[model samples]
Target: MSSKTYAGIPQEYAKLETSKIVLIPVPYDGTSTWQKGADKGPEAFLNASENMETYDIETATEVYQQGVFLADAVTENSSPEAMVEAVHKTTKHFIKKNKFVTLFGGEHSISIGSIRAFNECFDNLTVLHIDAHADLRKSYQGSACNHACAVYEASQTTNLIQVGIRSMDVKETTVLDPEKTYFAHELATNEFWIDSAIDQMTDNVFITFDLDAFDPSILPSTGTPEPGGLFWYETLDFLKKVFTEKNVVGFDIVELCPNKIEKSSDFLAAKLYYKMLSYKFMGENVEDDYDNTYESKAQKNNVTKFNDDEY
Candidate 1:
C-alpha cells in the first residue's frame, strides 16, 4: 500500500512526523443508490496520482515538497451511520495532531464526518460546497447519514456556501440560503457570481468538493453525473480564488466512481487533488525541497474581517 502513496514519492517525503499534509482515504460506500463501486474511489485516485507530475505550472510550485503523508485508509464500518461516526473520530484525531488533513471519499456521505471535524477545529468556518447535487435531503433512505443528506448537519451547524449545484429536490429549497447558494444556470456567463459566492464565506474555509460538480462530458464516472456543470478550467479559476483569498483549512473530494474502460475521470480526480494542494501552498516554501521544514502561512494573508461595504 505504501508503494502507491500519492505521486508515488519516496519514504523520506511521505513520513507522518515530517509531513505538512495528511491524506486520509475513506473507502466505504454503504449508501450509494444508483451506482456501486464508489468504495474503490480511494485506490483509483491513488493509482492515478502515481502518474502525476509533481511540478504544477499554473501555481509554479511542486506542492509535494511540503511532504504529503498518505495515512492508512479507514476500512471499517458496515453501515453508513457507523461509517460516518468512524470518519468523524479519525478526522478529529488528525486535526488534533495539527496536521492539514485532506479526505478522499467512497461516497458523498463520507463528507459529513470530515466537515464536522473541521468545524470543531477551525472557528468561523464556511463550507465551500462544489457539487452538482445539493445532497440536502433531511433524511434519505431511512437514515440521516445517507449520501443524499451529506451536508444536512453542515447547513444547520456551519455557514454553508454551495456552488455549481444543478440538481436538488424542491423540498430542499427550505434549507437552502439564497444569498449563499449559487445555482449553475444563474452563473452561465456571469463572472461576478464568483465574487458573490466568495462574499458569503468566512476567512477560515473548509471545501467539500463532489466530483460530479463537473459536467458529465468532463467527468462521467461519478454515480450521479449531471449535465450543464462547471468544466475544468472554470472550476479551477474559482478554486484558485478560494485558496488565495480564504484560508482553506482542509478539503475533501468525494463520489468518484471509477470506470475500468475510461480512466480519464480517475486521472482528473488526482490532478484536481494535487492542483488544490498547489493552490493552497502557492506562495509558501513550495519551490525548494522543504520536506520536513515547511510551516503554514495560511493566516498571514487571509481576510478575517467581513467587508460588508463591498457586498
Candidate 2:
C-alpha cells in the first residue's frame, strides 16, 4: 500500500478498520460531452486533499480525527456499464462494514451505480440531486446509463429532490416533478429554496452532486460548465442544513475535469469533500477517536450505530 492517503494523515488513522469513513475514488471517464480530462479528476482531487488541514473551521471540528480510509481508485475499463457495476459492488462492500462512504468521480454518469447501491442499503431514500443539468433523459445516445440519465432510476424509484438545476432537455420536463425540482433561474431571489428542498427529502438522503452545479467562474473543471451556478457559501449552507436535519446515508461528487492552469478547481473539490465529512460528523463524534482499536470505541459510544434495516 502507498503510505499516502486522503488528508495526508498518519497511516494509523487512515486504515480501514479504525476509520469511520471511506473515500472511494472512481476515475472512470465515460460518456463525457464537452471535456475529456475527467479521467484525471480523482487524482487531482486526492492530490489537493493531501494538502488540506484536517480541522474544518466552519464546523468547529477536526473531522479527520475520525479516521478516513482512502481506498484505491476503481479501475477504469472500456465498458462503461462494467465500470458502474464495479462502483456499485465496491461501495456496497464498505457500507456493509458500517463505514460512512463517499466517492469522487470521473464523470457525472458514474453516479448511477453508487446511487443504486445506496438505494439497496437504505429504505425510503430521498436523492438530493444538486446539478446544473437535469440528467433526467430516459436515454442519451442509446444508453440509459449515460450522464444525461444519471438520475433517471432515482426519479422512478425514490423521492428525487433536484436542486441547482439550470439546464434541462425539453422532454425532461415530462418526468421532472416541478414541485420538488428547484431551478437556478427561479431561485435567484428565493431564500426558502433550501428549506423547501430539504422538506421534500426523507430521513435518509443520498446526495449526488455534479460539479457543474457550481458557476464556471468558481468551478470550471467539470465535464460541463454552466453559466450561473451555485456559489461556495450558499452551497455549503444548504449542505450543512441537510447534514444537520437529515440522515445523510452517503454521497458522491462527480464531473470534475481537471486542468493544469486552473488548479483552484482541484483544490475546491478536495475542500468540498473534507467539508462534507466535517459537517456530517460534526455532531456524531465517538470516543478514543485516535486509538489504534477505535472501532470498538465507536460502537461503545454509539457513533456508528445502525441496524441493517436502517441502512
Candidate 3:
C-alpha cells in the first residue's frame, strides 16, 4: 500500500481514497507482434508521472484538485483471459468505491479486461476508440485475446466508435460498421466531422486511447508507428467535445513503449491523462482558462535576459 503526493494530497490510501480518480497500472504484454518491451510500460509511465506538473496548462486547471489516487500496480496475469478477469474485478472494486478508474496499460489487450469491468456496472455504454490500427481482428497469431484484438473483444460488450484509424486489414474493414468508424484521413480533411463522429456515440462513453494513434513524430515510442495521425491539439479538441457532449465513464491509455532517447512521449501521455480529468470536471470553463494563461506565459517568457546584440 505505497502512497505518494498526487494533486496536493499529502497522504492518501492508493485505491481506498474517496478521490475522484484512480490510476490502475496493468503491466502485462503478452501479445505484442513488433515490440516486446511493452510489459515495462507501466513503470515507465509512472516514473514519467513523477516529473509531471499538477497544473495542466492546456486545460487551465490543476486537475489534481479533483484528487487523483495512484493505486498499486496490478500484477501481470498469465493469459489474456486471466488478465481480463483481473482487470474486470479490480475496476469493479474501484467503481464500487465511487472512483473514476483510469487504467494505464501494458498493451492494448489490457483494455478488454478493463471494459469488462465497466460493463458489469453500466448498461448502454459505448466505447470511443482512438488508435492508428483498427484492432478488429478476431484473433492474431493463435490468440483471440491478443492485444491486436482488444477492440474486437470490446465490441462484444458494447458498441464501438473508432477514430484516428489509419491502418487495418481487409477482414477488419469488412466487419466494422462504416457509419461507426471514423478514419484519421477523414478527420484531417474535414474538421467538422468530429461532431458527427461524436454524435454516433452513446452518452455513456468509455474512451480507450492507444498511444500509437498519434503520428510517429509526436508518439514515436509505440510498437507500430503509423505515419499520418492526429496532432496534439486536434486530439485534445476532439476529447473536449466528447466530454462536453457525452458522459465519459472511464478511459485507458495504452501501448506506450518508453524510450530513453525521447522523453516527450512519456510526458505527453501523462499530461493528457491529467487533461482528460480537467475536461471531465471543469468542462469548457477550464479550456478557456488554460488557453489564456498558457498563451500569456509563453509570450512573457519569450524574451531572453541577455541582449541579442551580444551575439
Question: What TM-score number comes out for model 1?
Answer: 0.92
Badly placed stretches (over 4 Å) of model 1 are: 1-3, 286-311
TM-score winner between candidates 1 and 3? 1
Off by over 4 Å in 3: 5-9, 12-15, 283-311
- Give each model's whole-structure lDDT: 0.86, 0.86, 0.78
State the lDDT of candidate 1 residue by residue for 232-310, as single tens digits. 9989989999998988889999999999999999999999999999998888984455433212332342323322242
**Preferred candidate (TM-score higher): 2 or 3:** 2
Which stretches of model 2 miss by more than 4 angstroms? 286-311
Quick one: how many clashes does candidate 3 have? 1
TM-score of 3: 0.87
Query: After best superposition, candidate 1 residue 114: deviation in angstroms?
Result: 0.2
- Ranking of predictions according to lDDT: 1, 2, 3
* Residue 227 error, candidate 2, Å: 0.6
Q: After superposition, how far is residue 8 of candidate 1 from its true place, in Å?
A: 0.4
Residue-wise lDDT of candidate 3 within 1-311, one digit each (tens)? 76554433445423344456788888888788897777777777777777877766766776665557878777757787788778877876776555667898889988887887666556677899999999999988887778889889677668888998999899997668788888888886786788888878876788999999998998899888899988998889999999989888889999999898888888888777878888887753422333223234324323112222322
